[model samples]
Target: MDLDDHGLTFSADAVMDETEELRNPFPSPPSHYTKYTTHNLDLLALYNERLPDRRNESQAQILADQTDVPDWPLTQLEKPRIDWILEEPEPYYDVFGERWFVKDKIPSLGEGGGTQLYPEDPTVDRRPALLGILRSLLVTYSQLTSAILAPPPSINLSPANTEPPKPEWEEKVEWITVLAQNLMAAANDLRPVQARGNLELMMQRQLQLRREETKALHDKCDILDAKLNELRAAAQLISSRGDSTDVAMSDPTPTKVVPDDVLAEDVLRWAEEVE
Candidate 1:
């Protein structure tokens, strides 16, 4: 048998020999070639046998009759609660034990610094409690780290032995360091710099307003000075006119009245007082 894209074929002589054998309907003694060929052909026959047969119109109608068969409705699963501890792999290993699901552990800083065990039983779900603890730890760490990283106090201190800070303190310190780095980066952002610049600009504007006010006051002073000078000039003119009137009214004699210098001094003093 020869296999090709067109299908299986046999030479005319081979077919004739096979036909004579088939007409006798007797099994031939198996040779190596026959055995191998038979095995391959058997596999092909089995493969074809396993394939689904093409549906005829009658078979299709039979299937159509079963189309109205009711399908079983799907059921929904109940959702688990928040506290339920879903199984998770152990985070750490023990010297002698098979790996198994375990409760989560968090390092604690207390009177006795050690790891705090949190129960992970599904019935006792303590995620919220654990989260609260973690939050508190974070806050404590922030404060401690800030203190540690803060610049030294202005006053000098004597060296002395001090109790070691908690592990949470160290964690806080690390957190603050990272926070400071982030803050520094954020400070470099254009928005913050622009805000600073805007504040400076506002200060500049205020200064300019002050300067303008000062200039305005100076201008007003100049106007006041001009008025003072005009008043003084008017006072001098009145004194000169009074002297002429006294001269015209006198009997061409030396009539002694208060000295003009004294009167002028009195007038100038009055002007100064008024100013």
Candidate 2:
């Protein structure tokens, strides 16, 4: 049987042509084609499925809905929040662990041998100020507390030294430390008062700025109104004058009646330039 006649055989030239046509031009796939082709396409399909429809809403709206927005994002937005924090701030000593205080380096006193007063008043004696006294007490209290808490020195001695030390010394030192801490707490408490005062001052300044801006806006509005009125009067004058032969003869050129919008635009531009 003839293989070609039975459709089971091909010519040698035809086979070569078919092989060349079907041959891969590249040894390996192109970078872009292979880049993510191996990655699971189902991941993207799943992500698209999970995403919310945002046809009616904008991407910004969608993201905003998803994200937490601060109540006071800007300083201007928090203008009226001075008395907002009604609850008295909890003392730092109460909030923080005593270990933090213990680990913290003791804050140094005023410069110049740590005895310099707040004011260098020549008339007043070189006595320590109230702040200085508090600072000194705090330092002394902390030192005493540290020393009291220290482990007793190692020694091989008499039975008298073997007794566990009494708690009386620790109790007294703790009391003194508490007093110093209270004094320091009071000093810290005064800072909020100053902050509140500063806030009030800022509020007043903001109010003043707003008032000035309002006044400027009102003045601009008045000027625009005056200009609009002038334009209207001019238009009326031109219309009335159109009926008169003498006026028509005196000026052959008819005055262009500027549109209200055009006149307003010019006025606004002038106002902006002046500002």
Candidate 3:
């Protein structure tokens, strides 16, 4: 079959065959395969361009020997086979527009029960060999996005069904009861002494008030005694005045040169006049 009829003009087998002929030593080298020919020289240039510089010097020397090329200043013939192994085809490019090319057999839906490509109809269920791969990639991407965007789950401390136990409050109440008992015991021990002290203070205050009241009453009695003495002196003065008046009235004109008989007659006259 003419390969061009199937839209495939370039054959990897033809290129490999030509390369083998150039490496063979039994026949004289073909003029078309010389280093100056456009085809051979183009292939050699591409090979040299693609050869990695980091290859070991020993490997480079072996490659130079295999191609019957000198090692003085590296040439295209000395380049490794790996340099040309993935040479780009002319017809197509990779997804990123890079010049890598590969040929693969994409299985149809019914071929060897392998994965299906370009599936038709909405209802037909066809299992794909790459389903697990796609599922894993989607799951990984979703997990990454969720980790970046979603809020963290809340951690609730409350009980799910019933109330949590109150051990802290119960412990506090127990402590309070113990403290109250201790306080009651201390109060009982010191009750009589405190009551005795309060009673003594009250008695001292009452004694002080009684002393003040007694002093005030004694002062009032002293004032009353002084007023009674003043009244007795006034009564004695009145009594003395009355006694002098009586003596003057009984001896009227007796001392004026009269005899005892005249004095008696004078007393009778004065007594009759006073009656």
Superior by lDDT: candidate 2 or candidate 3: 3
lDDT by residue (tens digit), candidate 1, 1-275: 66544343547787666555544546353222333344344443443343356334232232333333112110111223434434334343331223333464432222134233344242565456556655665786768867777765454345673544344456666665554443333333336559989999999999999999999999999999999999999999999999999878876767667665577778889989999
lDDT string, candidate 2, 1-275, tens digits: 23553244446776555455444453333222332322223333333444467546433343453333222211122223434333335212211112223233434333223333344333554234555656666776777677778877555657777766555456657556555554554455357668999999999999999999999999999999999999999999998877796766788686768765576778889999999
Residue 153, candidate 3: C-alpha displacement in angstroms: 18
Q: Could you list the CA RMSD of all candidates, in the order they appear?
A: 30.4, 32.1, 44.7
Better of 2 and 3 by TM-score: 3
Please list the residue runs of candidate 2 whose C-alpha ends up more than 4 Å from where it truly belongs after superposition: 1-130, 137-152, 164-180, 188-199, 245-275
Backbone clashes in model 2:
0
Range of the 10 consecutive residues with the lowest summed lDDT in candidate 1: 69-78
Between prediction 1 and prediction 2, the one with superior TM-score is 2
What is candidate 3's lDDT per residue for 1-275, written digit by digit as tens? 23553243556777667566655655345433345545444545544554676354543453543454432333434444544555745333332223443554332333445332323332454235135434544565555565556565454466664654544434444444443443344344456679999999999999999999999999999999999999999999999999999999898574756555666777889999999
Q: Which parts of model 1 are misplaced by more than 4 Å? A: 1-188, 253-275
Clashes of 1: 2
Model 3 residue pairs with clashes: none
Tell me the TM-score of model 1. Answer: 0.24
TM-score of each: 0.24, 0.30, 0.31
